[model samples]
Target: MNYKKRVVKNNQMTNKTKNKFTTHNKNKKYEQE
Candidate 1:
């Protein structure tokens, strides 16, 4: 059970990081345009 919770937490963090990375890339692309 504890391991499952850790996995869930890690997944949440990864999703947040992925979201941030995508937004950053999009902004950079717009700047280039």
Candidate 2:
């Protein structure tokens, strides 16, 4: 159970990072335009 909890936490962290990366890319494209 503890291991499963840890994996869930890691997944959440990665998801947050992915969202930030996508937003950053979008902003970069906007700036270029």
Number of the top-ranking candidate, with TM-score as the measure: 2
Local accuracy of candidate 2 as per-residue lDDT tens digits, 1-33: 999999999999999999999999999999999
Candidate 1 has a TM-score of: 0.93
The per-model lDDT (C-alpha) reads: 1.00, 1.00
Summing lDDT over every window of 10 consecutive residues in candidate 1, give the lowest-scoring window.
Answer: 1-10
Q: How does each model score on TM-score? A: 0.93, 0.96
**Candidate 1, 1-33: lDDT as tens digits:** 999999999999999999999999999999999
Write down the lDDT that model 2 would get.
1.00
